[model samples]
Every structure is written in structure tokens, then in C-alpha cells.
Target chain A: MRLPSCGCCAIAVRCRFWESRIDMPLIEVDNLSKTFRVPEREGGFLAAIRSVFNRRFRQVHAVRGVSFCVEPGEIVGFLGPNGAGKTTTLKMLSGLLHPTSGTATVLGDVPWRRHSEYLRRISMLMGQRSQLQWDLPALDSFMVHAAVYNIPKDQYRQRLDKLVEMLELGPVLKKQIRTLSLGERMKCEICVSLLHGPEVLFLDEPTIGVDITMQARIRDFIGDYNRRYGATIILTSHYMADVTALCKRVIVIDQGRILFDGQLEALSEKLAPFKVIAIDLDADTDGYDFAALGDVLAKEDRKVKLRVPKGAAASVTGRLLRELPVLDLTIEDPPIEDVIGRAFGGSSGVGPEEETSAAESQGGDR
Target chain B: MTAVARSFFAFLRKGIAVMLQYRGEIVLWAIWGLVNPAVSYALWSAAAESNADGTIAGFGRGEFAAYFFAMMIVGHLTQAWDTYEIGHLVRSGEMSPKLLRPILPIWEALAGNLSYKITTLAFVVPMWCLFAWLVRPTFDTSAWQLGLGLIAIVLGAVLNFVLNYVFALVAFWTPKLDAMGELYFGACMLWGGRFAPLDALPDILRWLSGLQPFKWMFAFPSELIMGRITDPSEAFRGLGIQLAWIAVSIVGFRALWSVAVKRYTAVSG
Candidate 1:
């Protein structure tokens, strides 16, 4: 094998060395495990009273032997369904919860140790909870967080103005958090989280319960923040729109394990080998067997969609192009949600047939 | 020095701003504080009037008012309920955002507690004055007694905060902290010296009560103010007891905090 030149080799070695030292890995996780000891409760007043004396605990492994590293300035979307340990992983990284075993490091510090240096440099925003004190204006909440974060006056002002301008908070910053609409409050939450200019931003469903327009705006701002500060962002969201808009790479985890980790396109290429084929036939055709080409994903009024295995797609298209009086035809990769669902063996929503088709489609990637 | 003072004043101003907004809740809880003392006052006054000696249990009607009245304000300032609250947050996966902030949750809680006192004292001060005017209690205050009273209150507040924090740390070990709350409240209410002076209880009970950290929190402070411990030597001894409890609490807090965090289930974020 041809090797790199000495100058290039030196740079490569230096990069490897830095990666090894991990003085400041934007994100680092090593064999991390979190098992929740759930109290076993049986229905009835007797059991409740008995629990007072004979407490029984059963372990639920929420996260098991998970390990990964994220470099600075990288936007990695952690994808999983409910009970898939996605939120658990995010909590561990943000130091909201400690791991039962192994280690995790952010900015060269152990996360659960609650070191101030690490905390000052990172911010965690969850879509379901209000970090800002409610019953107060966005501006008031921002002031409180600014104090708690110990943000310098000048930096706080500059960052606040920048966020307010970007998020269009001029009209709503004065409104009480309770008064603001869901979309509006989400923006304000993001603003407060970023007020201190954190180097690492952990967003757990940051756009959940947001409208399409607000979601798009928040996604755009996240991209902007990353571009401006080179901040390392680890975001967890169930919505495909979030990952599609902002992340190039995604980590698919389920049942406390990482299922897939790579580029977004690579995910589809590796898991979904079938390209969806759309047909608009002039003549009505019911009971048509497109499964000969691959598997049928859906159909609507003279229009049909079939996911054909990658190699067969072109050949099948040629046959349908020749045989049917097709009004229009199109080819595209399956939806990311479908591909991800298929990757985790229909855990999200994809069915067995679709998973097989997606699996075959990914085989075509090779 | 000016810069330090200015920045401190800035924190103070911000603290005041936050305090005023929660002033409503603070006033409501202060009303709750008034309840127990008010009940005790009525009960003791009735007993004093019915007594042939016209003095029930070494405390006359006015003396009972002074004792319970002082208690109302002191207990309010020194109370903490975060042990169960924090546990609930951790168990329900709601505490992640708090851990993410640069400030410790304890620091924020402490600041909020201190700020609440500063604002709510408005009503507390006024109510005390009105009560004192209505049934004036003759106070015997020398320079030493006044000094001791102030010191006792301050120490009591610190000791209360530290002990409450120690109990809160238990949330890391046990998720069901409501039971812990019940146990702590029961112990502190009786042994903590809030109901009556530990000294007034029978010898065995009083001695056992003395071993408890609660009496130093409220009993000694009320006694110092009431001039019950007028003997200079005894007053010094009371101060010593309060100081010793404070030391035990601080030391216990340091040890408990680390162990509790270690045992913390480290809930899935």
C-alpha cells in the first residue's frame, strides 16, 4: 500500500495523537451503561404498605455498553424511538444523570462529576421542559440564566442581541413565557440556552411541538450557530425533519444499543437498497402486482409507489417505460424515517416486508 | 473594594428582583407559619387563665406568645423542602436541565430561599409588631442577651439549611423520599425543639432531646431571646451547644453529599 509522505504523515500522526489524548473531545463516551432500579409495585393498598418495609427493586437497563466519540463542530443527530435510550444517552452526556458504569467526557472532563468548567461550556435544552423560569418574560428568564451562567455583561449583551435578532425575538421577548405560544417559547428557550455562548449544545427534541415554520427557523439557527462558533452539537430528536435539515451524520440507537452510525446518505445506502418508483398510469389499474419488481410501499388514485431493489429499479423502469402508458415516472431513496425504522427491524414503524425491501435496497449500495 | 461591593450589590439587586416576584408565595407560606404559633398562643392563653396559680408550666400567657411568636418567623426563614422535590425531579427525568446550568441547583435554591426571606419579612415584621402591641410581652434584654439572640438565630438558620441539604442528598440513594420527608418532619417537629423547650421536658426526655440537632435549631434561640438562660455561664453553654451542632451538621453534610452522589441512581437523562 502506498503510504502518505512524511509531511502529511506528521500531520496525520499529530491528529491521531490529539484524538488519543482526549484533552477536549467535543464528546466522548466509553462503554457507558445506565440501569434504572425501578421499584416493583403491585396494585393495592396492602402492597403499598408492604413496600414501606419490603422494598423490591428490579433493574431496567436503559443504556448498555454504549461508546462513541464526536469531534468538535460536528452535528450528530441521535435517532431512536420511545424507550430506545436516546434521551438517556443525551442526559448522561449533559451530566443531568450519571452512568451506572464506564465513563463519558465532554470538553476534557467527566460529565457526572459536575465540574463548573465543563458546565459553563455546555448547555442542555429539552423540548418538554422549561429551563427558563416560567411566569416571567423571555428577557427576565435570559437575565436569570445569564447570572447563573455567570455570563460577562458585554458578552451577554452581544449574544442576547444576536440571538434576539436572529430568532426575531424583538416582539416577544417581553411577553411572559406562559403567554408565549409553543413555537415562540421554544425560540426563547434556545436563546437562553445559547446566551452564554456554550461550546457544546445538547438539544433533546428542541423542535418538538413546534410548527413547520418554527421548526425550519430553529433548524436554520442551529446551523447558523454551528457555522459561527464551530460549536459541537449533539441533538436528539424523533422528528426526521430535524435530522434531515441540520445533520449530515446520524447515530441510530435502539434498545440501549447503537444500531447504525455514519453519514445520513450512507444510512439509506446501507439499509435501504430499494429505490422507490412512482407511477402515474393513465388507465386505472387495480390488483396490479408490482411485487415482481420489489415491494409496494403505497398507492393513491391511479398513482402507485413500489420500492424496487437497486439493480432491478433501472431494468424494471425500462420495462414499465416500454409496456405501460405511463403519464409520469420518478425515482428516489425511501424516507429516512422508513430507512431508520427498517434498520432497527421495524422498531419505529416500518413493517417486515418493508424492512426486507429496505435491506435489499441497501445491499444494492455495494 | 468598590468593584467587589458594586458587583455584590448587582447580585443583591438581581436577588431582590427575583424575590419580589415570588413574594406572593412567600407571604402565603408565612401565613402558614403563623398558623401553628397562633394555635399554640390560644391554647397556652386558655390554660394560663384556667390555672389557679394563673401561670401554666413556668410560662405565663405573655411568655407563651413571645416563644411561639419568635418561632413563627424563625422557622419560616429556616425551612427547606427540596429533599422530596429534588428526588421527584430525578425520578421523573426532569432534572437534566438543572444539572446543565453553570450554577449548582443548591446554590440557586439557597439564593431563592435567602431572597424570599428578605421580601417576606415585610409581613412578618408587621405581624409581630401588631401582636406585640395587642398583648405586650415584657422582654428582659441586656447587651449580652440581645447579642446571643442574634447569634443564635443566625447559627440556627445555617444549621437548618445544612441539615436539610443532608436529607435532600438522600434522594440520590432512595427515589421514594416522601417517606423520608415524613420521618424527618416527625423527628424535627418533636425533637427539633419547635413544639417546646427541650429544657422544660422531663430529665430523660430532655437529655435525649438535647442529643438531637433540632433543639439547637429553635429551642435555644427562643430561650436566648426569652431570657430563660439568663445565667451568663449557662448562656455560654447554650451557645457552645449550638456551635457544636453546627459543626456536626457541616461535617455530616460534606460526607453525606459525596456518598449520596455516588449512590445516586444517575437516572437516565
Candidate 2:
């Protein structure tokens, strides 16, 4: 006798068969909110003693009415500040948490239900947490992972070899996880998580606490993994380079809500509607009154930087060239970090059309 | 073998390897397991010898030695620390990765529990033999009683593990469970026959012990191995009660685990 493909029934096989026929988002979340009831107490012994009979609690809305969808093979960056619910949302998607309200489906199954099949197809790596046994070698943890995922011996060996080669983990495989450096441990973590070839990957700050060179290497590995396997990845990183390098589309979230979602390049256009013009003058004109052109961001010996509205960038540059002896001139969008800071600071001067609401951003795919 | 069984064995192997790295600490813990039984045996035997008939509560000094010796073995085999461990895992955000696995985290915890027992056996078995030789414990157990006693020990271990794990689920609701863990251990010491034999307890306390599952986990197996439960019918009845409590504990575990996972906030990350 032979087992079914799913080791269950023909109906499940048919369901998979039909699932492949239709084009659907690999992950779909709608109004997914999570509120935590956190205990609160005042300082001092008197307040603490009084709180034994009457305790206080504050409800924290960690993720409120957030919605999003991810297409297959898309590396979407989940950008947010600390306590902005990025990890909370990922935890819910990875089945580590239950939503207070609303629903989410990953690979056509409810995530919080934590079905074995769903879990086998997805992996979430939290940089602060160690999936590997601290006292054991990386290889031991990998073997345990293989057994838990029920990977075939041949496939496990093949994937392990490839991941080791890709992640440069061969030297660290035999070293105890606690003895390894943060970068080596992170590489091992990535290697073990991908041993089973998860279709969906959630990486929360995968490059955190590592050197710039290691962060770049990890970023490159993530990009290569996404391309080679076409795995849909949702990455959260404090490093802008990680997002800008791997994710063509970025989701900006703040205060438990999605502030903006679309192409990474569109972020500046929507949030910071200004162009920076830097000019190198032939001679220093102390009385030129450069502020008359636009907001003089900086004025020095022979170089002047101006922040002009997007609509006035062309005219401002023509005037500077016509009046001043311009040696070289360049126009560029503001840095992504500055734009994000402004957005979070609520000083972006956003219009109704540019203020992409959480609901609107749900469908604002690239 | 099935995938779950394979995973369990792998976890067990890894747990044993981890335990070997902390040999000194484990030796101390194993010694501590012996101290409780040794002190209880010394106290009870001294009291029994003070009696005019060389007995207290129908237990002679040799009988008391046998009882405590059996208690030591049964207690070591049935020990579970999840009630102390789960709170730390939940509070420290360490349980998240374990929960991500396809299998329940309890299987890994159970493997770790067994690994501690298996690794400490080398250090503890010698100590047990030394104590038994020094005390000259009497043994009237027949081969049949020994066979049934082994089965009771296995069942009692399972019952204790399941019950402790079920109680540990309270950590999901209240992560700081040190007080709870201490309270649970205190209850086991009093009601599970670790402090004194159920036979020597006050009539009301002994009657209460019969109604609780702790006595089934510790006293029944220890008594059967000590030849105190001589009647075949009574021994089998004790085994039945152990099985029943195990079944109830497993059911309770299933119910509590679902609610606990939902309640998990994955604090700190």
C-alpha cells in the first residue's frame, strides 16, 4: 500500500492541486489586531503594598487594524521603530501569537491555528533568540531540526551542504553555539532555518548586533536565498541597507498601524515631497542671499545646499545657474532615513492622496 | 518509527549531551535527591526504634529503611521539574522557538526530563546501594510483587510527569511561578509520602492522601516494592488508580495546553 501525497487523503491532494491552479497571495492579513493587557504599578513600597489588593492594568494596542498581502517570491521589508508592533505582527503570522481580533491566512491556512503543515512551510528567525542549543554544536541543533521537520536524509544532507557553503558555516558547525561569535551564530541560525526550505520566511532584525561587513554578507545571502528559492520573505531590520538592497517594496508601520506601503522609491516621493539641490560655486558670494531661491539647508565657502519643493526643483536650479557662477550642480531625493524619521515624527506635510492609510496600503502593491 | 518518535529520540540525545557538559551540577542535584529520602528514613527509623516494641505505626526500623529506600528510587524515577522550568521559558521569551517546531514543546521537555534521569543514574545508583547497605533494609518482595512493582513505578512516573506538566501551564497566565513551583513541591512532600509514609500519617491526612493523585504517584509504588501491599487485588487496584490519574492528567494537559498557547504573549521579543 502507498500513502497519499499528504499522507492523509485524496481530498487534500485535490485541494493542493486546485490551490496551485489559482494565483493567490501567499500571505493575507485583514484587520489583524493584537492588544496586550499589561500590569501597571506605581513606584514606592506604599503603592506596591496597596496594589496587592487593587492592581492596575493598561491595555496596549500593539497591532491595530493592520492589513497586508504578500505575493509569492516577494521580499517585503517590514519597517518600524521599537515597540511599533513589527515583531508582534510577525509572531502572529508565524503562529507564535493569537490576534485579539480579525484574521490572517498564510498559504491558505489560518496562521494562529498553527497547523503542522503550515508550520513546516514557514520559518521565523528572531535575532535575539537562539533556536540552537546554547551548550551544543550547531550541527547537533541542525540534526534535531531535521528530525523535527521530518526531512529525508538525502535532502537534509544536500540542503545542509548548500547552506553551509552559502553561509560559510563549515568552520562554526563543530563549535558550541555559545562560543561562536554573533555573526557565526546568526549564520548557523539562518542555515538551520532554511534546511527544510520553508516557503515563507520571517526574519526580525537578522543583521542586528553584527559588524557592517557581516550585515552586508547576511543581506547578500538573504537576497540570494530569495532569488534562488523564490521564497516570499518578510524582513524587519533597523539597517536601511538591508531593506533597500533586498526589498523592492517596503511597508512602513508606526504606532501599531501601517503608515505607508508601496515601492521603496515611492516612499520619499509620497512622504518627503522635496528635492535637495547642492551647488559648487566658482566663487564665494557672501551677499548672494541664497535663501531667496529656496530653504538654504547649508551655505559654506563655495558650496551651497538648498531644500526646494519637488515642483520647484527645476526652476530653482535654473535660477542658481543663471545668477551664480555654478561649477557643478546635482539634484537628489532626501535620504530614506530622514524621510522615515520625518514620517514617524509626524512632520512630513503629507497630503490626503500621499497619506497612504493602512487600509489603502493593503492593496497598494508594486 | 514515526516522525514524532524520531524527534523525541533526537531531543533526548541532545538533552543527554547537554547534561554531560554539566556533570558537576548534575552530581550535586542527584545528591540532593538522596538527602531528602535519607533524612526521612533516619528520622522515621529512629522514632520506630524508640518504641517499646521496636515499631511505630506497625513499621520496624528495617521496614522503615526498606520503605524509604524504595521511596528514593521511585522519587528519582518520577521526578519532573517543568513546574519550575516552564515559567522561566515563558518569561524569558525562550519558548517561542520551541513553539515554532511542528511538534509540541512538551515532547522536548519530556525528553530532557528522561535524559536527566538517565545521565544521573551512574552517580545516583552507587549512592543508593551505599545507603541501602548501611541501613540493612528488609526485603520480603516476591518475584510477582517485583514485577508488578516495576509496572507501578513506570505508571507512577508517567502520572507525575503529566500532572506536573499540566500544572506548569499556569506559567502562560502568570510567568513568575517560583511561588507556585515551591507550593507544588511542598504539596508533593506532604501528600505524596516524601516526608513520611502514608501509613504513619494522621488518620485524616492519610484519608486525604487516598483522594489525591500524589499518593498514587509516590506512595503506592513505594509500598508495593516494599512488600507492604501484599494482596494482589490491592496492588492491581493501585495500578488501576495510577492509570486513572494519568488519564485524567493527560486530558487536563490537552485542555490546558490549547488555552495556554493562545494566552502566550511571547514576552521580551
Candidate 3:
């Protein structure tokens, strides 16, 4: 039996595509699925050769019935825990992979068809791979792109000069690609990718391996580029700062499905956002049995901590102070990463401060 | 017409600039260029020296040297390794930016191959001349033969480009295409007269090899240069076959490219 086709389906409401709750999303996907057959192997050299002839195949579904949408010029972050099919979805959108079943349309274009006009409108940068030739200087690579993109010589020069200045690629342009550092190479790659001034920028961890300063620089440049060109940006990174700094809306996927897709602040509130409110009481206070209020996180000689829903934080904190002994109280936001970690069946001790640096580095891994 | 040529040459200039930066690797590649063909020539020359009748098939020692040396030069000039390259580009999603451009990807690949060939030809020319002088074959160098040789070489280059590109598109389907690449080179080495002339093979093998485009790439050209295929009828058939293969390859490439692109989605799920 054939699987049902559900095109770019998502539960998120008031999306950029939905102006009056009746408008369709600029990008839509429905019941999208992709499965791959990987060979099952046995040890031994002879067996390896035998397997090559009589291969054993196992089907692994990378994306299963997942969907979402973005409006023109809206910067959206495609987020997910590791191996949650973020890259798989991005590849499908970029026309790099065929969906096994379902539908995906970007600005009304079926990406896999590789329509010439559609191709000319978008560009993708997968962090681990570079488009520039390894034997060439960045200038030479840029020149090749200028011709391929059919950029006028005059316009090419102006855009190149601006990119060089913004990316600080002057020191690296003349150097062979092999001689350039990782950060330097990434800068050149970005410059090369942008030569055509593409309208839709699909950046998959374009900042991976770059230094913190370089990461921030790239993010700023991305913002500036998007503002100047009004290009739609779809970025995927493990770094929360990337989403917080650049994207107002985020779609978080887990196990090849959309676990949460909405505004970043709204998602935070929807998930467990209230930090464990810990109160240290006077030494004279009797043993506080506060298990009924919420999940008790910890207890010390004079301190008691409680984990509660974001909506109940104010009332619970007020009640605790009014009804029981309380000396000091502190409230904070729970780390999104930690909350996501638990939500995805991953138990961890990720503090809130670590999210920024972790997310910043994630900028490099698409 | 003016717009296309202008754009092509602009990209070609960029291709040359890119190749210039690999000067260090160029030296290493030159060393490989000398060593690989030299070994093949030496081994076959040794084999020919052991011929019981002093002539194995139609090739004597002198003729073998002349033919192999010419084949080596032609092979170096016409070779393309971009198939493996395209695979990497697809897997890593680097093909994205290239596709984003106005020009087709094949044109860029062709320009890249040309840039590499012209740079590396410096080494091929010297090596060819050095080997030719060592294995001297007393021969006439008439203007007709020289002109025909020039034409044949140009035809050989075109044939090689078509063959390589047509197979390179296979990378779109076959991820690990090293075996296919080796098979292609092996065919050229054995039947194309890159190792020894097809005439030197058994009569049956010679007949079959003559039917191959590989023969047009090397054996046919070497024979024309030597003024062997002087009969107008035979020369016409040889040249015509080369053109036919070019036509076939062009059509084949157009069809294969569309099919191959259908399979490429840009990334592994």
C-alpha cells in the first residue's frame, strides 16, 4: 500500500505564510519522508567481497512525515537535536535529495526539478564542504563564479570589493586554498557562495570551525546581507545564540518529526521555562516539606528548590514566601538546551551559560 | 554568439588563474607524468625485444617506441579526471553554488580540464621529444603528414573530452567510481595504442580494437602521423569514425546528464 501524501504540513499557526489565517506559506511541506538502504555487513575479507556481490540492505528513514514553512525575507532557524533529520530536510529543500513520499515547495518551486530559473534564485553552504577549488586562490575562484553567475564585470568588482572588506579576506585572497586556515577558507567559501547575490540563502552550519570572533562576524554579515538584499535565510545550528540573535521563529525537530515549531519565546514558554526557584530559610525554620508545590530539585540546611511550570512560577513563588519560612529567593530562565535535551530523551547537566558558546560553535556545523 | 564566447573566455581565464596556484603540485604531477608513461614504454619495449620472429604482429622495436611515445603524449593531453571530482562536489553539497550560476556545470568542468591540460603539457612535450629521440625511427616528415597529424591530434582531444565527460556523469549514480575510471584508462592503454599499437595485437583483437573509438584516439592518429594510413579511403573512414564517436558522445551526454541530475538531491539522508 502506498503512503498518504501530506504536503509541507505543520501545526504552527500565524506563520509568516499565514497573513490572515487563510494565506498559504511561501514554503510548504506535507507528509515528507525519505528512507535510505544501508548495507548490513559481516566481518572477514572474504565476506566483504561476498557482500559486495550479494548485498544485505536495511532501510533507514531519515525524514518521516515532517513539515514547516517560512515567509519571504523571514530568517528561520531549522533546529533539532543531533541526528534528528535537520540536514536531511535541508537537503530536500535545496533540491539535493528526493523525498521518498510527500511534497515540498520553495517559493512554489519543486527543488529537485532543478529548474534553471529556480536554481539561479538560491544558494546553499554546507559547513563541512567548500565550493572553492583547493588548488586556486580565492580571487581566481571568485572570478570563475562571476562568469558562472553571469555577473557583469563592473558589478562583480563592486560586490567582490565589498565582500572582501566585510569578510576581511584581503590577506587570504591571493593565497592558495591549501595554505589558508580553516577560518580563512570558510570566509572565502562564503564570499564565493554569495557572488551571485542569491535570493534564498540556505546555510547549514556555515560558521562551523570558525573562531568565536569570526562566528560573530559572520552572523553580523549575514544579518547585514539579509537586510540589504531582503533575502530569505534558513539557518541550522546547534547554537541557541544563532537562533536568538538571528531568527525570531525556530522549528525544532526530533526523531524525524517536528517536536516544536513556533516563535522562540513562545517555544520557551511552552516548554519548561521556569528555573528551579531555590529559597534559603532561617536556621530556626522547621523542615520544609514542599513536594506538593512542584518537583523538588534539591534541599540544603537552609535552602529548598522547586521546579514548576512557567505559568505557575509567580503564584508558587509568592505562596512559598507568604506561607512558609523564606530568607532568600532567586528566579532564572531554564537553559533551552537542557530542556530540549530532556525532551529528546537525553539527560544532561547543561547550564544556561553554556548554551551561548555551544550554540556559537554550532554555527560552523551545518 | 558574442555574449557566449565572451563569457566562456572570461571563465577560461579564471580557470587558468586557479591552476597557476598549484605550482608546487604541478612539479609533483610532472614527475608522475614522466614516470608512469616511461614505465609502460620500457616494459613493452622489453617485451618486443623478445619477439621470436624479430616482429611481433606488425610492430618491430622501432615502431613500438614511436607509437607508444606519441600515445603517451596524446593521452596526457586528452585525459580528464573530473568524474571523481564531481562526486566530491555532490556529496559535500559544493555543487550548490555552481548550480546557482547561469552557466551549465559542464562548461565549467571543461574549462577546468583545459586549464590543467595546458599547464601540464609543458612536461608532456619534453618527455615525448626525449623519448622520440632515444627511439629513433627513420621516417619522412612531409607537410601533408604534419598537417594530417595536427588534425588528428585535435580530433583526438575532442574525442577524449567527450568520452571522459560522458563517463564523469556516471558519478551522479556511482559513488565509488574508481573501478570505472581504471577500466576506461585500461581500454585506452590496451586498444588505443597508448601501450602498444593495436596492429601488434592478434589479428582478431586488432579487428575488434579497430572498431573502438580508442583506436581513433591514439592508434589512428599515430598511424596518420607515421603516414601509414595514406590510402584516401582508409584515412577517410578513420576520421569519419572519430567524428561519429564525437556525435554519439554528445547525444549520449545530453541524455545521461538529465537522468543523473534526477538522482542527485544534494545530500545523504
Q: Where does candidate 2 stray beyond 4 Å?
A: A1-21, A271-338, A344-366
Which segments of model 1 are wrong by more than 4 Å?
A1-25, A40-57, A273-337, A347-366, B1-19, B22-24, B265-269
lDDT of 1 by residue, A94-161 (tens): 77677888777677688888787788888888888877666667787777676766677899899999
Instruction: Summarize candidate 2's per-residue lDDT along A133-217 as a digit string, tens digits.
Output: 9999999999999999999999999999999999888888999999999999999989989999999999999998999899999
Q: Best DockQ goes to which candidate? A: 2
Q: If both were scored by DockQ, which would come out higher, candidate 2 or candidate 3?
A: 2
Expressed as tens digits, the lDDT of each residue in B13-56 for candidate 1 is 55577667677777887887777667767777777779897775
Q: In terms of TM-score, which candidate is strongest?
A: 2
Q: Residue-wise lDDT of candidate 3 within A218-244, one digit each (tens)?
A: 888888898888989999887766777
lDDT of 2 at A41: 95
Give candidate 2's TM-score. Answer: 0.87
Query: In model 2, which residue pairs have backbone atoms overlapping below 3 Å?
Result: none
TM-score of each: 0.82, 0.87, 0.79
Q: What is the C-alpha lDDT of each candidate?
A: 0.75, 0.87, 0.73
